[model samples]
Target: LRRKRSSVLRNPPPLTTATILSKTYYNVNSHQPESLDWFNVLVAQTIAQFRSDAQHDDAILRSLNNVLNGPQIPDFLDEIEITEISLGEDFPIFSNCRVIPVEEDGIGGGAGAAMGEGGRLQARMDVDLSDFITLAVETKLILNYPKPRVAILPVALSVSVVRFSGTLSISFIPSSPPTPSPTTLAFSFLDDYRLDLSIRSLVGSRSRLQDVPKIAQLVEQRLHSWFDERCVEPRFQQIVMPSLWPRKKNTRGGDDEDVGHDRR
Candidate 1:
């Protein structure tokens, strides 16, 4: 009796990535969300949390201050001290969505629910982060007209960014067997995100210091690259994919071959 039970257990039902893919998209089509509002809210809250958390982190604050104010002296520039940097209050606003359908071959070609067998979503949004910056700088005196020994001055720099937007492509596939409980879902990013950055500022630390505008431009470029690497890329690769599609245990017993067909 033990031998028979063991044999029965050994030949447990087979499950494959293909099976999971089918069930995942099929269920997604069935349980289609009424609105993408939740996603919008999620993004907004995430940005807010990131800002709040970053502000609280002493290391981050100090590091940023150092970067802006540190003793990196260039030609005609003596020192630049960034006193404050206020991140904008803007949140991610959901603009549009495009639905994609993936086939059993793991190819996404068709559009809308007609190809709901393997449904994917492409969501787009805009992010505006106009950083308000305060700078104190000491410049090299080109002319001999010095009223005081120290030439330190206050500078208000406004890096007014119009927008930074990107499109997020998501693919939902299945996990686990088709049981009484709801089917678990896994997902991946189908495409890369490209963020556009725009900056407008009237920055002049001193009438003689012409490099302040250039410095602002440098800061803008640095910010764009930094966000692309640290924030956007990691958000998709590390956070979104892992959070949505957690690794599941292999439930199969023996042979890769199924005991029976994978019923959709």
Candidate 2:
């Protein structure tokens, strides 16, 4: 969150025209959503291949571990170690895939957010993943202020994503010169969603408390809150999509790699 805040501060909002809203055209809600059954099948195949690759390699796990350990630890936390990770055995099922009109800001109607004279199209899908995906980590919780390292507790937690059912809405934001950013894909989950988690926790140094009900409850609540703040309902996630146009820097298939001048 600190990193995100700093980045937001560094790169302020781009300048925009005062009459941009007046020039915009909004999507009408009169038309029904268009089905995308064929699209669903193609996406399913891609997910299957991804799961197959995950099973054969620890690359995903290594990357996940690096992400967890890469961030700077706060003064009140230390010695964070990833113990285990399990990528679920089954694939996510995406059904009821359909495209619908949305606001220019990429907010879909299903999210119950306010709309206006804005224009864009968004794809909505029902995603269901029923499998056990778990991550276990051990860290130390340090207590300071009154005195340095007054208390240090070894906290171990294992959280399993038991099941997830949600309505995922995806949309695209057109690239513009003023922003100095690429075309972006934005996605978010509606407020109405079900997420089941199995969490286990142990906290202490020598005499450990295993699966304490209060700790489990707190962790579960925190996880849900964290998720809601980022990518739920009105809040959405955006990914900058790089230009796909072939470029000499990445061109291949010649007598030698990066030899774009040579004909294949």
Candidate 3:
């Protein structure tokens, strides 16, 4: 009976990163000038959502702290710190995004599961772009650029049977012009630049793996909304600018002469 109860009591496994990646797709035009800003906004929004939702779930916060404090990225461990967190467009850069607990749910759960015991928790995160850039440069994952374009990189999440924790890292690169078109006067746009989102967990813990799918979904939805509101609609209006109207190309002399003779 104990074995059967254990089996029955076990919660459904959380989603995995691979599975989440396969199902999500971004239709935004990443090659455009505004793509970088849009990407940054999306990343910021995602980190904010995670931090906000994680509040009222103490277990998740504790788990997140453990992962941040662990040896996952020893090079960056000292550089990590949390500062003021808020929603909206005031702060454009996120340095070190992390999760922390403010309260406890009576029921026991890790990163992904719904809170138990009817208790709630709260979470907050901080970001400092300069420090993040230093760490990325030291790690050789990024290089110096004249004007770095915004980038969102994935971080690993650590989880166990009773605790969950994780860290988020972001990078930036200089924005570049859209790739040139092959044919004259024919326009082709670039879309769907992949965001490198990675989640890692400690031994014997699978907190983020289970929640990855749902987290991916949430991220996709939020980003899609942000792009549509800020980038897509405005750009669509600008694309039809009067300056880009079709021009009539002059034909050869023979064609003009032939038309004149036919008119006579």
Best by lDDT: 2
TM-score of each: 0.43, 0.65, 0.18
lDDT of 1 by residue, 1-264 (tens): 656766667663544434654765634344433346676789879978987897777765677667755677443344554544566676655544544443444322222234334434333232233333232333332222354333433344445444544554444423223433322223233335444444333333546433355656776787766665544522333221123222233234666646344433
**Every candidate's lDDT:** 0.46, 0.73, 0.31
Can you tell me which runs of candidate 3 are displaced by over 4 Å? 1-35, 64-264
- For candidate 3, the 10 contiguous residues with the lowest summed lDDT are 132-141
Task: Report how far off residue 70 is in candidate 2 (Å).
Answer: 4.3
lDDT digits (tens) for residues 1-264 of candidate 3: 657786677776544433333454321223121224555689777867765775656665455446545676534223233221222223234222222222232111122233233222211223223111111110111222344423222233221111112212111111122533211211111123222222222211235322345534554465455444533311211121122223233223544444333321
Instruction: Arrange candidates by TM-score, descending.
Output: 2, 1, 3
Mark the 10 consecutive residues where model 2 has the least summed lDDT: 108-117
Badly placed stretches (over 4 Å) of model 2 are: 1-62, 103-117, 143-150, 177-182, 205-208, 244-259, 262-264
Q: Write the per-residue lDDT of candidate 2 for residues 1-264, one digit (tens) a residue.
A: 656676666753442322332344323344344466676678778877887888889898788777776766577878678898877777677777665655554563332222233455567889888999899999988989699999988889899999999999987665555665556778899989888999998888767565577878987898899889989978888778776656676586877675556432
Model 3 TM-score relative to the real fold: 0.18
Model 1's C-alpha root-mean-square deviation from the true structure amounts to 12.8
